[model samples]
Target: MQPLETRKDYTYGTLEQNQLLENPLEQLSVWLEQASQAGILEPNGMTVCTVRQGRPSSRVVLLRGMDTGLVFYTNYLSRKGTDTATNAFASASFWWAALERQVRVEGQLEKVSSTESDAYFASRPYESQLASAASPQSQAIERPALEQLVMDLRTNYPERVPRPEHWGGYRLVPDYLEFWQGRKARLHDRIVYKFKGGKWKKERLAP
Candidate 1:
């Protein structure tokens, strides 16, 4: 690429402290809805980052549930799952570029109840259920072998596919959340909500 210089001002909107909701989770839900309305693809997609042995790994996962906290599903034996098992802390972030908005969440991670996981798994499409049960996530495998596994699963479970014991959902109970909105020039907007003393404390940060 030639000098690789790309520049654009963010004139979309501003994130003021007064515009934020008292409950960060509720505010996040509102933003997520707006992102979907704005036609942004995969509005629920978020970057989930986990640490293992001082090393951090990040990947995009679709947000599945948003009741008490952010929820996503994956194999317990996966890299992210293993990392959370070791550290119990992770961060998830969402960037709606078209909306010039971003949100970051950081907190303790815990596995959701198996019942919840099973319910969500049951709600998934049949192909997704098979894929989750068949593929050994975060592992090396040949394409043909993987296909064979899926085929075998289809043969065995012709009706309702059972959720794998190793696959489930995890919820990140956030203690910290930051909402960002792009502004004119290099000056952006950032508002943080920190859980303190059993209540949420809202504050603004220099951007």
Candidate 2:
């Protein structure tokens, strides 16, 4: 057996209360834009986590919408959808390693209105729309059958693809948001916002 050894120091930047906006959404938008400007690939990519039967599941999903809350789309019958249905809450995290930064969001999930879902879906690429419409999501299918299904969808909907009823968006209204910045000497900065008493409270945490 062999142990892999690797390490690096992070001194890209620091985070402070004065640098943050009073609203976490504003802060998140700022960081998200910074990552995009910094040329980090897929700056909107995030790991979404859900719990089911007392166990947790996580997967990387691209963030498709954000305003007052974060939005992502998936098949409503997928495993994650089932988990969220039972839990009605989830956590998401974004890590931009090149920027030595990470953001964590924990919140309740809400289905976005159908109109909103359609608007986003309509904006997706033609193939993406076809893929989503063809896939059974988490359901099991034979390899050839799945490939055939996709091909059939492409042939059938060569011009346009309609959004599936099961395929839509979910928004996370975060009550807890954490912004972490890696620092030199292994010391890190952890700033968090907690929604309490109908407002957000800011605090620093040990890392």
lDDT of 1 by residue, 65-101 (tens): 7987999999999999889888998999999999999
Please, what are the lDDT tens digits per residue for candidate 2 over residues 1-207?
555674788999998977889999888999999999999999999999999989999999889878768999999999999998899889999999989999999999889999999999999999889889999999989989988998999898888898989999999999999999999888999999999999988999998
Model 1 worst lDDT run, 10 consecutive residues: 1-10
**Candidate 1: residue 166 Cα off by (Å):** 0.7
lDDT (Cα atoms) of all candidates against the true structure:
0.94, 0.92
Clashes in candidate 1: how many? 0
In candidate 1, the residue pairs with backbone N, CA or C atoms under 3 Å apart (3 or more residues apart, or in different chains) clash, namely none
Best by lDDT: 1
Compute the lDDT of residue 44 as modeled in candidate 2.
Answer: 96
Please provide TM-scores, in order, for all candidate models, with all chains considered together: 0.97, 0.95
